[model samples]
Target: MRELVFALDYDPGWNTLADTLADFPDARVRSLSLHATADSLWRVDHATGSPDALSAIEDAFLTADYYADCLATEPCGADSETEVLDETDDTLVLYTYWQRTPVCTSIPHLALEHLGDGLLFETQHEQRRHTWRIIHPEDADIHGFFDALHAELSADVNVEIIRLTGLSATNTATFSAEEGTLTREQREALTAAVHHGFYNTPREIDLGELAEELGLPRSTLTYRVRRAEAEIIKQYMNHDPVSPSDPTS
Candidate 1:
């Protein structure tokens, strides 16, 4: 198998969903699951941010016009619907079902057309960037897929190739850890803290400042950072290996 990882950096003016993400730099959305056919797409997404950010994201996602505009196609107004599966101060889970005609150009549809079936997709969206990781057969036409994706996107959307390599057991284990070991919120908190020098002796930023920057409550940010630190320390001390029973492996 081979793994293809790429990112689309959007000019917010071209995509409303990306525009909303641009407005809230601290907000992030990751796909829990995605299933797509020629005529339909079903997706479950997990989002992390402050209450206001989550509310804005929910509004952008549920509004059919947003999808239509993003896809640069005719409206799928009645053909799409979204449900809030769960929500909290810092997290929101959403399920969306969208029906599309062949004319609608979406990433999944493009993948189906060029890469064929039996491909695994992992995706995340944050700060006007959408990243996609696809695991597919060795023989998949990756070049064709990339070309098609470039052709489909508007001139303002920049496509970046992050990785394209033969998948190894080590890569599989790494992907498993990334998707399973840390919750999205935990990862986000830990990343922000580390980036802003929360661990430095002379800290560059305090916990409260980091919390404010992330648009998360102080207590909530503290909990997530603490939990993430504990998890990292445990993993280091125990030298835990990716389990043989792991589904991804």
Candidate 2:
């Protein structure tokens, strides 16, 4: 199967939110999740990048022109049921439900329905991050999918393909980090790593701070991170063993 991740810098004509997020100098919408079912579209936004960013979020949602009214609003933790931790200063967890119909139909949404049950979609709002995982079948055509999307969305958006890769079953296991198999500790460790920008170049949080935030000893946290990293790499590499002497591997 193959997955394609892309970002769309939408045209102003199609932007449902009236306020420009760029206006806020310090605020940024991070790790946004958009779930559009048959009846409603909900956006769960995680605020980071600045202490006052949460206020920016409040302003955006309050001034958005898409919905007639707010369906619901609530505090949501990042990828778990637990509340946002105080140590993580930038994590402003929030979810807002929009009762009105979507102003514009998303190309990914149509593509998933067209492919039936084989494809999965994960998307974001302000960042407009989109990931599509397609289980390849005899009839599937990657080229055709891109062509169709171009035809449908080109008028209102510039679609840029960021990355595409093929993953066999073994490799995809690590990519997904199967929650069913990972212990709670492992999940939290991995999730925190992502949230803290550990994967980015020039690293945001050091090992010590990450350990402090998770309230674990540095050695224990290192062990958990390595185990989770190993689990993922093992799947990607088809269970090939890392060199015993090189922990960085």
Candidate 3:
């Protein structure tokens, strides 16, 4: 399999959803699941933010203009609809079903047309940027798909290719600290770092601040985090699946 990572930046006036996201910079949206066929598409999206932001996003989802702007296609037909599957003060889950696939120019449609089936997609939306990660068969026509994507996008949408890499079947292995893949201290440090937004863009907290919060020396915290990260990456690269228990037992 091969993986492709890319991002799309939408100009403020060109996309209602993007503009709304830009208005609430702290809000984020992620695709929880997606299923698309030649004639239809359905997806579940999760959004997290302040209540006001969530409200605004929900409003956008209810509007036909948002779908039109998002898919870069004509307005949704009568058969299309969106439902709020769940909602809370700071989070919203939406399920959308679209039946007008023939007029849609969404990424999924384009991918299905050019890349064939069995492609896995992960997406994240923040501010005006939408990022996509696609894992597809090794024999897929990646360049052709890229060209089709560019051709389908509007002039106001800017696209960037972040990565294109081959993946071994085992490279999909994941790490679980609870399975003894990481030492206790390392897990704690890593958890603290993430909880404090150390990995966020423009980081919400610095290493020194994180160390102070954890009551640890800066170097100690740094070392633990680094070691934890190294272990996770090693597991991913080495395809060493962390089993919950000894299979031989």
TM-score of each: 0.66, 0.44, 0.66
Specify the poorest-scoring 10-residue window by lDDT in model 3: 233-242
Give a tens-digit lDDT track for model 3, residues 21-46.
99999999999998877777788999
lDDT score of residue 210 within candidate 3: 80
Q: How close is candidate 1 to the true structure, as a TM-score?
A: 0.66
lDDT of 1 at 125: 86
Off by over 4 Å in 3: 66-70, 73-78, 169-249
Backbone clash pairs in model 1 (N, Cα, C under 3 Å; residues 3+ apart or in different chains), count: 0
For residues 1-249, write the lDDT of model 1, one tens digit per residue.
667777776765777677898889899999999888878888899999999999999998887473522255345343677899999999999998878755666888778887779878899888777889887765565656666665676655655555555555666423223347889899888788779976543346766777899898887886676566445533432332345586754
Candidate that beats the other on TM-score, 1 or 2, i.e. the better one: 1
Clashing pairs in 3: none
lDDT of each: 0.71, 0.48, 0.72
Name the lDDT of candidate 3: 0.72
Off by over 4 Å in 2: 11-19, 24-27, 30-34, 67-89, 98-104, 124-148, 152-156, 169-249
State the weakest 10-residue window (summed lDDT) of model 1: 233-242
